[model samples]
Target: MQDRTILRTPLCDMLGCELPVLLAGMGGVARWELAAAVAQAGGFAMLGMVREDPALIEAEVTALRAATDRRFAVNLIPAATDPLLLDAQIGRCLDLGVDTFTFFWDVIPAVVRRIKQAGGLVLHQVGSAGAARMAEEAGADVLIAQGVEAGGHVHGRSGAFALAETLLAEAGVPVVVSGGISTGRGLAAALAAGAQGVQCGTAFLATAESFAHDYHKARVVAARGEETVLTDVFVLNWPMGAAVRVIGNSVTQGLGNRLLGHDPARLPREVIAEDGGTALMRFSTDSPMRHTTGNLEAMALYAGQGVGAIRDIVPAAQRLHLMADEAAACLARAAGSRA
Candidate 1:
């Protein structure tokens, strides 16, 4: 638990856990079972708590609290300026009594200050050196360098390689590299490229405990190269100009055709109630809920190039355990000799 192994990255030290692995905070796809399983597996799993109803988050976290006595994290989306919803999420999470939290999207100093003052550990997520610098100044315990290759909404133009290298060269805090990590080779590669640890998303998306819809899960299984496109088709439904990468389908692919290139914020926004409904079911274990179902043709299929690496559906614990085991052995054997 305390050696110079790949798992002993700064994340392990920051979270006070044994392993440096963190599960993807895929909303809807991120479920209670998966989070708990990861924590139980000796790594940390983050609960994606961006758009769900206040009650749903409360229920899930309450269950998570009962399940794992180990260290875990709750991820929040802050790109939008939804005061009511954001406050509700912070309130619920605080009520659940979680210690560590990962803040996604814009850097809100007040949230960071408030959380710190309240004794909660906040890890600010950013996409560029500018973002990372802002997070460090904001007092983030850790900075997650989420590259363009990562799933969900990306806030930085900097790729994983450059952002990570740049951050490590100057930043004072620990930098965890996220986006497109799948193979043990990827983990080895990221570390060799100057990352303290790698955060895996697409790999865990194929797991069993994930609440992603059956149809959505199948799409992940059936996807091929270049199926993904970056647009605000769905994000247009959001309040701001949030650009997310997803598989280009009918409703989604047409967004680009609809315009010759314009501002995303200019597009129409979806009703919060409907948008909330869609997100909740997109990752339902049994069936695709609102978020997963309605967007099927052009749904937000947030994925990375690592999609090709996912071969089978397995349990959450087994997934993290296997990745750790593989990364360790892979690093050891690779480090042994290059000849």
Candidate 2:
């Protein structure tokens, strides 16, 4: 096996991780179990706590801490979450001594400032060069350049590589590229393009440790890259114009002409599923989690363009090691080609 240490970058030192890989802080899907497994495997793990209550955040953080002592982050979406709830979430994270945070969607300067004031490290995920600059100025320690190929609540129109190239040139902070990056070849490509690291959601989400429902994981394993669709059909909880990339399902297919320019508020709030006794409505951004039941196919089955690469559901640690080993081999091959 290739020495995986050869694949490490400066980002590894900064994040206290052995691999320059980050599990995308996918809300609901990336919970304590997945995060702990990834962290134990030497990849940076992020607990996806988007719009979740502080109590849940505290409980998840507690579990994560109990599982692993390695550095991890709590992912939050300030723009999408209620201000009071977001505040409480941040507070809970800080109280738990979690110093690293990953913020996605719109970059809220005030929220960034608050984290920075508390001496926390902020990794802001942005879709455009403009947002990159904003996040950098707002005191981000690292910037994650998210591309349109990313699953769930995409913000930028440009592809991953193109946006990454632009951000690498413009941002002072270290940049990590996200979207459609599943395999080691993809990781090697991003590193060759000067990205410090790669953030992956779809790949990790398909793992056995992921909190996503088994049905959702199976769909990702069976899906082709083109089988995924980028649409706003599931915007019940998020703001209007918030686009997401999800595996095509009856909900998205049934949209037909109503794919765009329809008011989500006007749509019927039909309960399609249930998560721990809470109703999961149709058109809601909530993806099917492990505990969720009823009409799983109709819920948002989020997946990246890299879904085609995921053929099986393995443990998160196994998946992370495979990615690292592959990246090392790919880098060696590239270097040998140049020689």
Candidate 3:
């Protein structure tokens, strides 16, 4: 194998990680087990605790700390979550001594200030250059440029590489590219384009350690890039105009004509699924987790455009190592081409 050092970027030094791969803090799917596995493998990990109760956050953080001493981040969506809950979540993370926090959806300056005031590093995921600028002004330590091809809740309409290029042009801090990146070649491409790192969702979600259900993992493995669709059909728990990229399912397929412009209030309150006694209504933004039970096929099966590249479910550590090795090779080949 080529030297792993070739895959290291300045992001590794800033985040105190060995590789530039960052596990996407995917809500419901990215939990303690997956984060720990990635961190233990020398890549940065993130716990997806968006809008979760503080007790659960404590538990997940405790579990991750127990598994590994490596650095990891907690992801929270300030705009999507209630203000009071967001405060509590941030407070809980700070109390737990977490030094890194990642936010998505909207750039809340006050939240960023609060984290920064507490000496926590902030990584904001932005879909547009305007948002990226706003995040930087809000004191974000790093920026994650998410494109339309990203899975789950997408923020920017621009393609991944285009957004990264735009952000890297003026971003004072490191820029990590997200959306539709699931391979070592993708990582190499991001690095070649001057991105400091890559945030991956679909690739990591399909791993054996992910909290995603087996059915969801199977769908991602069997899916094609074109099989994924971006629609506002699943917007129950989030604000209006919030779009998500998910595998084509019966619910989405049924929206033959009306694929967008869905008003969550107008949607019928039909419980399509449940997790731990919580009723998951139809059109809910919640994805299928390991404990979720119901019409799994009709629920939101989130997957990026890169889902087609994923063929098997392996351990998170194994996946990270493979990607690192492949990226090292790809980088070496690019260097040779220039030589």
Candidate 4:
């Protein structure tokens, strides 16, 4: 990788990281090990706690603190959580000395105020310019312009590049482009497009430290750009009616072109593996978590369009370093070409 200095941007300064890359805090995928690895690698790592138990969240935060002193952030989905549960989790984080947070779905004014009053930074994830303005008005310190190609429950209507450009023009805060970014060129492209940094989920899901099953990782590696589709069929229990990007699997194949139909309850719930089994919940966005058994291929394999760029499951730190180097090289080559 080029000198870490070469890849530094305003986002790096604000987040106190060495590089302008962020590992997306994907609820089940971006766990303690993966977040710590990326943070340790000089890039900002974010832990996803949208569906996490309060105790689990506390334990994970303690574990990451034990692993690295570098700055990291946590993600919360307001729509998916009850007010009491959300407050408990956030309180636990604050008590543990965590200050950086990212909010998905909708911005919670109370939560934002709590974090800020405690001297924390808040990042609000938005899918459009209007949402960006709303988030900025809500006092978000940073903005994550999420695009349509993002994995999990994507709420954006435009592509990442276009959304980033739009958000930069209207939102008076540093913008981090999310969705469909995986390679060094992707990082360079986001920077060139006027973004402070890029937040990547699919790329990190393929990392060695990720908690996704090995079979799921392999599926991500072998997937093509076109193999992914957006659908709301998986939201059996937590049906927000939002379309999620996922690689084609038995479940998706059965759903076909319809975005919403058929009851998820009719589908198989118990996955019997070689050892213990796991139950697939309706309306739950949990990816095949680590140690998940039984018909794993039938579960939601959440991934972005960048799945095509993933070929191997390397350590999170190694992947971040390589991406930084490749982005620096790409920008250098582009500059030379223009000259």
Task: Score each candidate by Cα lDDT.
Answer: 0.70, 0.92, 0.94, 0.83
Tens digit of per-residue lDDT, candidate 4, span 1-339? 475575678888899998999888888788899999999988998998876778999989989989999999999887778778888888888988888999887666777788888999998888888778777877899999999989878887799889999888887789999999889989999988889999999999998999888988999999998899888777754545667899988767775577565455554464334323446553346567778766677667899998898899999888888889999998888878999
After superposition of all CA atoms, the RMSD between model 3 and the true structure is 0.7
- Tens digit of per-residue lDDT, candidate 1, span 38-75: 78877778887766677988888888878988777788
Candidate 2 overall lDDT versus native: 0.92
Top candidate by TM-score: 3
Across 183-272, the per-residue lDDT of candidate 2 in tens digits comes to 999999999999999999999999999999999999999999999998887889898878899999998889876666557878789998
lDDT of 4 at 108: 61
Alpha-carbon RMSD to native, per candidate? 4.0, 0.9, 0.7, 2.3
lDDT winner, 1 or 4 = 4
Residue 278 displacement in candidate 3 (angstroms): 0.6
Q: What is the lDDT of residue 104 in candidate 3?
A: 97
Q: What is the lDDT of residue 261 in candidate 4?
A: 53
Cα-based TM-score, every candidate: 0.86, 0.98, 0.99, 0.93
Candidate of highest lDDT: 3
lDDT of 2 at 19: 93
Error of 2 at 250 (Å): 0.9
Q: Where in model 4 is the C-alpha error above 4 Å?
A: 261-278
